[model samples]
Target: MTDNIWTYLMVGITFAIYLGIAIWSRAGSTKDFYVAGGGVSPLANGMATAADWMSAASFLSMAGLISFSGFIGSQYLMGWTGGYVLLALLLAPYLRKFGKFTVPDFIGERYYSQTARVIAVFCALFISFTYVVGQMKGVGVAFARFLEVKFEVGVGIGIVIVLFYTVLGGMKGITYTQVAQYCVLIFAYLVPAIFLSLFATGNPIPQLGLGGQVTDGAWLLDKLDTIHTDLGFKAYTSADVNTVDMFFVTAALMLGTAGLPHVIVRFFTVPRVKDARLSAGYALVFIAILYTTAPAISVFAKTNLISALQDKEYADVPQWFTNWEHTGLLGFEDKNNDGKIQYYNDKNPDMDAVAASNGWKGNELTIDQDIIVLANPEISQLPAWVIALVVAGGLAAALSTAAGLLLVISTSISHDLLKKWLKPNISEKKELLAARLAITVAVIVGGIAGINPPGFVAEVVAFAFGLAAASFFPAIVLGIFSTRVNKEGALAGMLVGIVFTATYILCFSVFKMGGPEDYWFGISPKGIGTLGMIFNLVVTLVVTYLTPAPPVKVQEMVESIRYPKGAGAAQEH
Candidate 1:
């Protein structure tokens, strides 16, 4: 079959399965809507958690980032992986034992203040919306190329599909659908990676292939380094970023992963605290399968991309190039009217002589990094079915996380804002309706944001992680571990952390207030969250000492969650 036919078949079949699961598992009550009736098995929840955790950023953009940024991109791999370990060990079990429907729910009750709850709600909404924008962008990119539609139109389609399942089934539908999505995305990711690995290094395992020799008997990484330096770019194995910034970015991502409300909420669906722990373990295994292979895929794709396209004739370019060009994500301008492509770092001083000698006016090829993974299969001349499968996987990764984030947004409004704070006596049916309505609005807003995102998928996601790290990490950690952290402390800390981080990101990234010289203490906006998190911790500690301690009941509640009986009972209070 043609690529279009295979894409439609795979996408249609997978989407049909998702919709079927949604209908089958649709929530009938507030409890079901919020936590899938709180009876999910550990294995199933683990799969769902894996799917939820691996968003568009993980499946689509991580490899692409590594392909271009070289060793500096290891920060993403290390931070996110370390962050998941932090979440599994430090946060998941305790939060599950606390038996809350959402992160805000835990903060509100644990701190004994509706004011604290409201602050957490705002933080959750802000962080989730920022994160979902990245997922929406991923969806648009996939659909635009494979489905042959405008990027905006692809986002619209994604919004509709996510809205259908998310609104109809709520957490119940999303959970089971994510389990299926895990299978699709993992399979999609591994198939192409394995193919490329075997073709590149005669090894079936991508991880092994990364270190194996290429056809010409040179180490793969060495060849990549030669290619990179030849093109006037840094060696693929070298780190160009400073150590402090790398540490801060890695720390922010780690803390952010632990504090992400959507991933945290997945534990609530399970039946017991032990189940939560088990699911966390299972999720780590599932997640590692993709995470470990990412660098290898990065190496393979980068080598293939450079070998195929660098300095190639524009007219004689491969079919994939023309296909991607029509989508507007890939372009070649005949700079110097040479009718040839130049893909290199033109700004590099060392390359100036090379460019002049070669009669290259300037680098004339434009390639969006987000397209690398999606276009990898095509660039490597994989079969049509593999390409189609990748499109489905990209959509699966995007939609699963989008559903999870939108659910967090809706739950914050409907549960935290309306039911818990504004109208404590609201009916369950009405609250469920409110949740659906809230998600509908969030989907539209997210779709609009996706159309014109502030940055690429990974960059935008890094910002969201920064926000989560600065705002939620401190509050949750203090609320659980420290008995003296009062509502005033938690509230003040979250407000300050989020405000400072958001302002820095806005100034540097969004507004372009100054160049790299203006970075505060040599920290970029992406890494400033580490500083904000420190500020939050310091403020929380100081405020706790200055103000009265949390009430005796709240302190006891914290103690109870920390040391629950029988691997912690999972029944909600």
Candidate 2:
């Protein structure tokens, strides 16, 4: 049978498992819908959080970026995964002890202001919506490529799957479902990585193989650097971006990871504040399994790709090459028409001399880095089963994250927006219904976005992080550490952070309103959140100093949440 058979079988099996979990663990009360009844075990929640955090960007895009960008890409591996350490130590426990259904709820109560709650809800929606669009688009791309369906149909299918589980069982279902997704995604990610690593180097372990000598007894990094230079590209292990830019970008991503609403809500599902800390540790271990492997996979995929295509006769190119080309993700032009292909950085001035000496016309290949993960298996001539598994894995990643983000959107709408303002006297059953209704609407919006996505997952997701870091991270941290941060200070800080970050991103990245010099201090819009966070901190402190301190009762609530000594069992209202 063709690969599509395995693709259908594996994807169908995974979806069935998810739906089964949803049906088995259906949510009844608001607490169950929002926080999985606050009873999940640490290990189970850990796996769920890993799945929720990884998303399509981590599973599909990171390796591709690292494959092309090389050494500088390590920042993502460190910034995104290492962030869990910061979360475990800094944020998770306090929020867990506060024992809220959502991050905005905690923010609202902690600040003791409805306006602060509203600000948090808005920030949460913006960040979660930005993230869900990527996942929904990933679902469309994965299904289109693997299932041989129209892109629209694939996206519709994905949205329906998510709506069925999330609308039906809410966080309670998503929690267990994500555990299964974690298993499927991790297995699919590791299998090809191990095979490719063993093929490229003598070592079977990918982390060690990344540093190990190649078949020619050359250090892997050394060999890649040689290839990079020969192709008129920067050395594979060199920093392509400026140092200051990378530092700010990495810091923004780290803070964003700690602040993202959906990921933060995972700890709320666990039974106790201590379990939240332990779950962060366990979640980091699960995430590290992939984060550590991705760079190795990047090197392996890039090296294998160059080796396979460079200087090879066009007529003799493999079917996988032609397959991807048909999708327009990979392209070629027979410029020289000498029946052979040449792939290099033709824009490099030094390449003009090389092209002249080799009688080459121009660079013929145009491959999008986003295609690397999906195409890696095909390029390796791996078994059809493996390719199908990767398709399923990509779906798992996209679906798991979409489910989480949809929950965030829904919870905020029902709990923070409607429940707080319109219908304070609503019953538990009606609240559950409202949450489901909100999910249906969110899924429709997300599907529409998937049809016309904003940009690449990695790039757009960075913007989401920037928004989260700028809007929420500072206020939340200050609220915990300093009881004096009153409502006006928190509100002013959020408005300043969000407006500054959004305007910066809109000017530079979205509108292309300015060039590199137009960026503030040469910091890319993606990294501007670090500056925004600092601004929020400063403005919040200044405003707090200018205003009266928080009332005594509010100060006591902050004090109660600071320590874990009497955290007791997780309590839900």
Computed on alpha carbons, the lDDT of every model, listed in order, comes to: 0.91, 0.86
- Mark the 10 consecutive residues where model 2 has the least summed lDDT: 564-573
Say what the RMSD of model 1 is.
Answer: 1.2
Clashes of each: 0, 0
Looking at model 1, residue 402 earns an lDDT score of 96
In candidate 1, what are the lDDT values of residues 218-320, reduced to their tens digit? 9999999999999999899996668889999999999999889999999999888888999999999999999999999999989998889877888899888
Please write out the lDDT profile of model 2 over residues 172-254, one tens digit for every residue. 99999999999999999999988888888978899999999988889999998999999999999986578898888899898
